[model samples]
Target: MKFFTCSVIMSVFLQVCSQNPLRYWTLLPNILVVEVNGSLGQQPLSCLGSPQEGTRKDDKSQGIIWRKNGVVEEQRGNSYLVQLEESLGGGNYTCHREDGSLVNHTVVLIQEDQTERRKILVKTDQEDYLTCLAQNYNGEFHCSWTWNRNRVGKVALIQVGRISNDSDAQCSVDVSTQRWTCSSGQSNFSCSVDEHGHRISCRDEQHCPYAEEIQQIYVTLYVRTEQFLVENYSKQFYLAEIVKPDMVRISEVNTSMIEWSYPSSWSSPYSYFPLTFQISQFRRGCKGCDNPCTESKPAKTLMVHFTDVCQFKVKHKAKAVCVRAKDALCNSQWSEWSHLRLRRNNKNKHRQNDKQG
Candidate 1:
């Protein structure tokens, strides 16, 4: 039912957007976005001569003019102090030289009402719009989200820290590097958005794998739509809970025996952080030949520890083997199956893989 409503809103928006492209130009990368709480009484915006320069802002005093949505505004000199008692300030403000040359521009977005959960991105098959995963306990993770069919959005701000109430935590993006950094007392994290703009990879430099996690990591993503609307989504978790091992790399050792190994992306000191492998094998004439792995009974199932054993003996009638792995210490997601078909002839002809039961 929610999806149906989104489709209806999308159709209506498409018709309105087609008629005016420049009016919705806030989606462009050139303009900066400022999020404001409309409930606040007043706000001040400065029209700096070198606005893009971080350290030097609001330095322009002479020969400066301000305009809101391309309309000239005579609100004091180089700066406009607007009242935000009821709504988001002037839609988009651009600073121009006295001769009308463009200097810098910004769009002000009123933060969405948290209770209503305004729609900027519709949920995918998942219950939520965001999906995050970590390959190992290396203090690194990546989060991704799918875009809506009718809306184009970009990451306007990212806030990450150990506590959700970290009032001093601030984030800033470097467009040239495509990287952003968040500074907080508990943890300082840096993230880089991918070129495609669909995903963000972040790292916590202070992570210690040897110690237990006492606090949760909190992450919030602020996305702005083309129509100057903004919405925020957040998540919190401990890295261990989100760790997912990569697929196991299985290879045929010989016709009578097969072996498997850990994924390359897994952390070192295999014994300290071991993996538990599950192997399922089936006979050539198994009951479910069409989907052998799922239907066939595993000839042999072994839960071998890395330090103890990594190989398994194949059964005489076994035709194929499927293997997967998970963190031995923690109950986590399983890796994808590594499969291989065995040959009755010499091992060189083609070796069977994974030690089944």
Candidate 2:
């Protein structure tokens, strides 16, 4: 019985000594082996002391081994090699020591390639309300549409569809309420906008006439803000010599020199005004001189000579007169003729001279 008691004490002591204090753990190929030293006895330690089911803690004093199932290698060292079963998504991971102290770790999994989402469908058209096309859209993410350039029409807020997730955007003219609607089918779209103040009419996918054509129709407006008073001036008219020498005697010269004079009152203080004159000569009771002579000139005062000489016999009536002159600003009426009645007899000339006096 004494011997049995000694053996029992010895076994207890050996078990206590085999429980090592300095233990090192690491990962190796296909196995997790921990090494314990500095103890009184050398014995194999069971790694499954307490089942490390989940994440491991980082405590040097604790005798627990915890790791994920993917950790295929473990050994007695500072670090261990962990073989992952599959790629890990971006998330947080922890490494635990035997003492239950944990080290937080982050893991990122890289994909082979990246791909963008494609749009299902894209469309555009005109709108009646506001000015542009009423937009309808459907999608999961946010979408937008815009005119590529500034347009003649007014722009409004983008309209998003409730049922389909469709969004619409457009710009339109103010007067006619015409618009061009552009949308990104999935990613991008393009459209043109006019900056000029003109009406744009889109027909069958074509832009209407430009702003220049519209400006040609409407005259530019000019406004003056200054104030001033103007005085009213009365206009006056006077007889002016439109045709010089209104009367011409066919017998006075081979071609008569006709001259005229105007009233001083007819002169204007502003500038010279242009006038046109017409002269006419008439004769009666002469067979060869029955045809009248007439001439016209554009001048303020004109001197006209008659090439047709009078062939009337004495005692025949011949009349030469000054016709009227007309212009944009003024008009002068005809003057009375100085009638001459000739006689074939020299005695009749003396009588006519005496009668004229």
Candidate 3:
């Protein structure tokens, strides 16, 4: 019975040790040498148990107690040591356990030193529109105009002649209209910087030329007003009387047929005037010559004769003119003298044989 009781007690003790593994614990830096005399002890003890298990009633608690330099620096675990020296002044320090459930030791924490603020510079091309931007490591900065009144805001500046603005950062000047306003013939323009302020100046109306040529070519005349006044505004004036083609004349070669054409400015689809030619031999400078040709009406082209009685003789000259009339008044221009030279009999016979062959 006695042996069975000792065996049962040993079995229960082994089971408890195996189940509550927190009984074995380790602490870092087992020895702390201090410069002052103090008393130390551990309190508010806790456990570092396995993650798979919750707090068990059989879990063992371990701690430490020591003294140094009249101050208490309590630590926990086995093989602990504390030494006292004279260098460290009197102060209160506390060191907590890894789990923060207990105070293990104490040391004073001093404040760290600081560094100076950083500075940066920005630059760009002077010819371009003024634009400013800044960025830093912390991604926060401020931008403002340091020179010109036109660019007084955070944005860029644009100034052309008298027009100035901050929203649109580019300046443009219309030099063509500037010349017309100054009544100048020739104009030169240039773009420059106003560095006294930060404005971009576009200069115009400098070194202008004469006035007569500028006034004559620069006038804007509308063709629509002339058409409106001729058609809609005036009822008494008709277009047929004002828009007639001048220099009308006529000519004839023989009695059988007549050929005619005109040199009027009346273009296609606007006017189509035909001619009628009458031929007569009134006066002559020599043989086979017809002179002093007159027309009863204005004809369009020259007259051609196809009759046998009016066969063209050798070395004969015929004159004709194209004529067009309006309101019984005719305008005429004469054509070049049409020399009526007949072909030889042998040439005509050869042409007939070539056609037949």
The best candidate in terms of TM-score: 1
Candidate 3 on 1-357: residue-level lDDT in tens? 999999999898666534322111211122111212122211122223331221342233243333333344454432232221222222223333335444433322111111211111122343312232211111111111232232131111122221123121222324331111212223222443333333222323342221111211111110011101100000111122122333333334443233333324332222233222223321222344353234222222334422112232212222222222222122322233322222233455698999999
The lDDT ranking, best first, is 1, 2, 3
lDDT of 1 by residue, 1-357 (tens): 999999999987665434321122232354433434334443456666332442243345556787888898886345565544333553687778878988777776655345545567767686777778888888898888887767668887777778755575677778564798988777889998898877889998888877888888878887877666677788888887778888876777877888877888887678878888888877654553665666666766766666445798878777888888888888777777777777654443334433331
Whole-model lDDT for model 2 versus the true structure? 0.28
Q: How close is candidate 2 to the true structure, as a TM-score?
A: 0.16
Every model's TM-score: 0.71, 0.16, 0.16
Which stretches of model 1 miss by more than 4 angstroms?
1-65, 68-91, 101-105, 164-168, 284-302, 345-357
Better of 1 and 2 by TM-score: 1
Error at 290, model 2, angstroms: 21
lDDT, residue 355, model 2: 98
Candidate 3 or 2, higher lDDT: 2
Per-residue alpha-carbon lDDT of model 2 for 1-357, expressed as tens digits?
Answer: 999999999999767654532232322121222222323433222232322422243343243343433352244322333322111221222345556565332222211111321111112243211122111111111112222232112222112111123333222223432233333222221222234322122211221221111110101111111110001111111112121222323233212333343322222221343334444444433335542232322122233322223232221233343333333233343333333322233455688999999
